[model samples]
Target: MNRYQADVPDGLSRRARSFVRVHGLRVGSLAVEDYRSEWLERGIPSAEIDRVAAFGERWGGLALPPSPRYNGGPRFFTPDTPETDPSGGWWFEAGEQRASVPYGFMIGPDGEFGVHADRWVPLHATVEGWVESLSLTYHARLWAKSITKLVHDEVETIDLTGYVEVPEVVGLADSWWRGPDSLVAIYRGEAECLAFPAARTAYIYSGLDDWGLHG
Candidate 1:
């Protein structure tokens, strides 16, 4: 049997299996609340909090309030769309240089269940010499303003490691529902390598030692 078939537990839906197939491995799973706390601990400023708060005030309270039960997880932010065609959004930055990467959350609509955006680079691209090395993509949709009576107020942390064989499991969630799959590689961090997936939200971290992949 393929390693993935062996590693993947039974009971995942077809959609879920498709997700796992596109991405290699499942790193670690956690509740939305846990993910948020980790992001904060990682030094990501609470930029989303301020933005949501300001929006609420400007709009005479938010159409929906932030809820961890629905929307909260590791998030990416972009100033605008990366397409040659212009889309009005935020520009993404990596160190001193800037790229047209999109940034957002990996959460559900009700303001609970997933990830959120902070001031840090949720998904970043790496450059090696004249060529771009990696590309991280993301997709998210709003579920509801709140799910249960309880309101959410935290981000979640999804631990990532290098060496997952599937592309979708490399990052966080699978990108099946999102438009199309995207790939990204991190060459500067503790893991220096490249990866590609059919989805934007998932990734495989291959540690620092093994930087190349071969069949």
Candidate 2:
């Protein structure tokens, strides 16, 4: 079994399996410093830098400049958020708020990080297999966003063939086969959105102004 499979919930729907595999590979490519630098470089502007400071605190400490690094953090997902779903794996960075409203990337659970997800796949609902059901869909006509995943697995093979570009997951929930070659991928711009009979959750940005989604 692949190292990523050790943590995968064995019976996950095919799409779920694909999700985990893709992200496991992604997380493996990153080192500890990448996480810290991303926050410091793209971090929201603040005088005290308190948000990143506290965020780093959860990770133990924040390193900077030549040897910046985040120490003692979860292997998958950021430290849990306090105000919302304590059950969620990560909280959207609260610092990048736009027009006074929170707008940032978040993963793990619906409504936990100010992201309202439309359920496409209904798993057991505990969040164990939850992270395995996320992917990116970009709308470049509006803004740019880079998808990120946190996983730890080593693999020599990563097949990029599973990606597809579709119109909508909402349309596929009612009709998609469970065949070996079955997949319903939606692409808005340059990114592909993985869709499934059991995977409709997404960070909703359609109605929010001064706010939009990158993935």
Model 1, CA-based lDDT? 0.23
TM-score, per-candidate, Cα-based: 0.18, 0.24
lDDT of 1 by residue, 55-101 (tens): 22222111111212112212211111111113322222211112222
User: Could you tell me how far off, in angstroms, the CA of residue 78 lies in candidate 1 after the best superposition?
Assistant: 18
Runs of candidate 2 exceeding 4 Å displacement? 1-6, 9-11, 26-76, 84-101, 104-215
Clashing pairs in 2: 120-198, 120-199, 120-200, 121-198, 121-199, 166-185, 166-186
Report residue 135 deviation for candidate 2 (angstroms). Answer: 5.8
Model 1, TM vs. native: 0.18
